[model samples]
Target chain A: MSVLIFAELDEGALKKSSLEAIYYGSKVAALTGTSTTAIVLGEGNADELAKAGRFGATKVLHASDAQLNEGNAMAYASVVAEAANQEGADVIVLAKSSLADSMAARLAGKLKAGLAANVIELPDVSSGFRVKRSIFTGKAFAFTELTAEKKILAIKKNTITPEETEATATVEAFKPALNDTDFAVKVTNVEKATGDILLPEADLVVSAGRGLKGPENWGIVEDLAKALHAATACSKPVSDLDWRPHHEHVGQTGIKISPNLYIACGISGAIQHLAGVNSSKVIVVINKDPEAPFFKSADYGIVGDVFEVLPRLTKAVQEL
Target chain B: MKILVCVTSVPDTITKITLTDNNTKLNKAGVQFITGPYDDYALSRAVELKEQLGGTVTVLNVGESDADPVIRKCLAIGADDAIRVNAEPTDAYFVAEQIAAIAKENSYDLILMGRESIDYNGGQVHGIVGEMLGLPSISPVMKLAVEGTTAKITREIEGGHEELEAGLPLVLGCQEPIAEWKIPNMRGIMSARTKPLKVVEATGKDTLTHITNYELPPARGACKMIPASEAETLIKLLRTEAKVI
Candidate 1:
């Protein structure tokens, strides 16, 4: 049973979450005594995708199709299904990003395979494949058993650390038969954050809530985040108030993240908010109110004004 | 025009999550159940589209009879009718098949569901249903507007968002800001009791996946407080002690 990793590219660079998927898929392949393969699609840099060999992918298949530059779910699913058949892959892995998840859904239907999304761990494939996944917005976990010959798995972000090995992969090009109808929905325009790190892949995150006062005072949070090289986030209320983009909202109704270090400022931590970031390795809370519920869950608490403390913290990190 | 919105009853966001029965199932004791928050956007949009296009909005659920109250709430919120498939949804594939079969029978103009459920986090049903019915499916759509038989959708891609257009007989997995949630009024609540609710047996078979058990996440450790004046000390701890910075 060969393992296949679907590495989705973000503006020519591989998504950081894809690296984690490759690392995890390769380990699963090794556990099952099979070679690992990665399928690269769209207008991504082939050399970068081939770097998956360092993460345990022994083979990389790149489909350099201009028509697939703006990927469509149905078309990509068909292409991935063909590649999986060609590679003799019984298990397919993908990063649980929104687009890959969309494609994964179509791929499951096309392959008539069972799919388990938001998987956090590899399966015990010695018998039937059994894996663990987060449910209820990371408040609890569910162990799922997939009793199927062919299965598709989407790995949640930050679940696995990439281990780079000394290896080079043989990059090969493969093409699948596709038609204009495959591009059912034509993309008209795109808006992006350009160079900013994606929230899901950030190792360090600097988040704020209403405690920051208003959008005008966000400069301090941005300054501290810049000093620490972390992605920015906000509470649900902040997003609801339009203080930040909806994508940056972190809570039960927003993006669930598990960064290595999460620094929350001025945010009164609600259970819905905690549901998103509780999985972080270390949490630091800075708020004026010491009784804030977030402080109870924090690894370190500092009772102070974010306005005064943020500048000092930024300067201190720079001095170090 | 006919529209169907899929609603899921999930544990409320504030529910204290726990495990029961040897950690094989969720402990429902004292838990409050509500319609999935994301799905509220889809349901509200369905009701809005129904009002504008002079059509009927129907709510669909794959759950036991206990879910009837939730369906009625959705009806009160503005749906014209409801359909409850009498079965416990095991996985996305099982639920999608039931939806696809129902849609095939009804031939609705549009089918909408939340991008994902808060409980399972499986955002697979919309795409599976679309593929099964051979229709166009767009997910994570933030903005949707209909004109005649075409629908303009704003969907999120990796690191960016895109605007796309597709024809009717489509599936949309909705997210935030697509449509504001609408609350049920006293008049609507009273009318919901008289609205028609059709209960049908599930027609799909469970495939490929089953939950073996469930477990609560480990509890957090006690927090350690630090002085507000010690910025340099905290930075030092983050570096040498935490080794994270």
Candidate 2:
């Protein structure tokens, strides 16, 4: 038995989240006394996938089918399930992104395996493969154990620390059993945003809210994010008001992010917004109002005008 | 275009979470429940699709009788009917099994749900259901349109989005920016009282995962106040102590 990991890719390179999954799967494989094999879907550099050996993958399964490049959860799940069965894997691991979560769920059902999602910690194999995960909008956590013969886990991005090692793993191309019907959904066009950082995988996040005053004043937020090499996020209201795209919204009604450090500028720390970001390791809030609710949850607080605070913060960061 | 929208009842987003006396269960004191926010988008979108295409929209939930009120709320939002699988959501896998069973029985042309429920935030149900029914599933969909037997969906990708076209019998995990949510009206609320809400025993397999205990996250440290004029000091603190820069 081995651990099968889905190594996610984008624009022909392994995504940062996949590295976390690889590290996580490798740890699980070590605990279970099994090897870790990575499956690469979509178009990506084969050499980079083989380099996943640094994170503990013993081998890489490269499915280079053009049809597999565009994601369809059912198709991806079917292929992964078949690969798991063929390799006699006891555990299947994936990132907890929307795409991975859907595929992991379906793969679990197809394999009739035990599945866990949004897992933050590696399981203790001695105690029936128990893992810890956040629930209730990061409000609580539960330590769960999978009892089925086959277990599947979706690891949250940035939660697991990726350790690097030196080992050259072999890469082999494996063709999954798929047909035209499996491609029920076909991709007609691909539209990608031009940016250096993806929000979900970002380690540092700089977010703005209505405190910026208006969309024209968003330069401070953007400049701060650029100086910090962070992704830019906004409050739900900002996104609702069309100041930012919906994907950039981070809150209870938006994307929940747990970056290493989250700097909030102008956001008042609404409870809904807190539900999404309270998981960040360190939180810094910049607001003119000392009574802003976000201050209660912040690891650091700056009671000042964002217009003045952000430029200074950005300058300071650039100096660093 | 018969659309099936699945909604899950979960703890309110702001509810203070606590473990029960047994540690294996959640504490219920003062906890309020509501329909998962993601599901609201899915339900509203399904209602919109039904209105545009002139089709029946049904809402499904996998929960106990306590979830009936939320199910009725879905009906009030214009779902023609409802189904409540009379079982505690054991886990994502089990819940997906229940949904898949219902979907197979009904043969819905389109299946819709939130990307993930707030309580568990598994984000696996749509994918699992699609796999079980051998149908296409697109998640984190930002835009969707129906034309004849095909669905034009704009899927949210990293940094950008991808547009795809799929036939009927597809699953979509609706996210934000899909559409504006609609509130239930008096007429719909009254009509919901008479809508059919069928409760069926769960046919899910034994739950493979078991929660050993619930734990709250470590308390955050006290906030350190940095003077607005002393921005340089704050930046130095971040670079040296915080080491985030």
Candidate 3:
């Protein structure tokens, strides 16, 4: 039996989440006493996929197709399902990011396999493949077992730390049958933000709310984030008021993040907003109002005007 | 064009999560259930689209009898009819199987659902159903428009966004940028009582994933406060004590 992992790539480079998946897939392969192979869609450097061997992959299947450059959920799912069938893979793994979840679910249905999504821990293969996942907005955990012959799993991002080992894996080119309908959804244009850290992938996050007063005072938050090498985020109200872009908004109505550390400045945490960041390992809240709801959930709290507190914090971080 | 929008009942966002003594089941004493927020967006968007395109809109909920109130609420909001799968939602896989069965028997032109249910947040149903029925699935969609048999959608990417075009027989996982939610009017609420709500037993595969138990996260530490005047000191503290900076 072989384990097949879907390696995600953007503009021909592997994403960090894909690396994490490779690590988890490698472990599963080791536990099952099976070989691990990686399948990449579109044009990716074979050398990069082969490097996944450090994480347990014995081979990399690079499916290079010009039409597959842009992500089409149906097409991607078809390709992965076909690759698994061709390789006789018993298990298929992917990162639980937007693209992977979308494709994994569909692939499971196509293969008539069992699916485990948002998995946070490695599987226990001694019995059946039992995986652990978060439920109810990180309020609870669920341990599940795959009962079907084929299994598909979407591993959560940043859940598993990547460990390295030395090995050289072979790279092979595979082609899947495609048609016009497979590319029905044509990506007309692509837009990317100009920043070093993407909020979803950032380990440390520095966020602000309406408490910052206005856009003019944002420099302090930005400075602190830069010094800490953290991505900047905003509450819904700030994004609604146009102080920050909607993409930077993190709340129940926005993106849900579980960074290692989340620093909130001038933000009064509402339950809706808390539902998003409650998964952070550590939370620090800075608000002038001592009774702000955010403080209740914070591991550390600072009761002060963010405008004054942020600059000082920025300077201290600069010194460090 | 007939649009079928699926909704799921989920725990309220602010509900305090607690586990049963065994750790395998959720403690439901203080938990209040509500319609999944993402489904609300899908319902509202479908209603608006039907209004503009002159079509019928139906809301489907795959859950036990307790979901009737929310299913009625969907009808009040503008859905022409409602369908409640008479079964406890075992898992995403089981739920998708039920929805796919309904879609196939009904022949819906378009299927819409929230990106994921808040309770489980698996984000799997739309894609699974699409695959089951051989349809295109677009997720985390910010913009959508229907013209004849084609749909134009804008999907959210990591840094920015990407626009795509797909034909009919498609599935869309609606998110925030779809449209503003509309509250039900008194007239609609009154008329919802008379709308037909069909409840059917679930049919298809068994759940592959089962919950072992629920666990509440550890409580947060006490808040720390620094005077507004000592902002710089707080920053220094973060650099040294907190180490975040």
For TM-score, the strongest prediction is: 1
- Best of the candidates, DockQ: 1
Each prediction's TM-score against the native? 0.98, 0.96, 0.94
- Every candidate's lDDT: 0.87, 0.85, 0.83
What's the lDDT for candidate 2?
Answer: 0.85
DockQ, each predicted model: 0.76, 0.75, 0.66
Please, what are the lDDT tens digits per residue for candidate 3 over residues A184-242? Answer: 67787777786568787788999999988898888889898998899999998998888
Clashing pairs for model 3 are A301-B224, A303-B225, A312-B232, A313-B235, B23-B213, B24-B212, B24-B213
Residue-by-residue lDDT tens digits, candidate 1, B1-245: 79999999888888988878998888888988899988999999988888887898999999988788889999999999999999998788889999998998998999999999989988889988988998878899888989999899998764557889888889999988888999999999999999999999989586779898988888778777878988557777878877889
Global CA lDDT computed for model 1: 0.87
lDDT of 3 at A35: 88
lDDT of 2 by residue, A79-169 (tens): 8988899899989988867567667767877887877777888887775678888887778888888888988888776768898889767
> Model 1, residue A311: displacement in angstroms?
1.0
Off by over 4 Å in 1: B158-160
State candidate 1's TM-score: 0.98
**Model 2, which residues run further than 4 Å from truth?**
none
lDDT tens digits, residue span B1-245, model 3: 89999999888888877777788777778678888898898889899999999889988998888889888889999999999989889887799989998998898888999998988878888988887787888898878899888888888877677888888989999887687887899999999999999988889757876665555666766666666676566656655776654
Give the C-alpha interface root-mean-square deviation per candidate: 1.4, 1.5, 2.0
Per-model RMSD to reference: 1.3, 1.7, 2.1
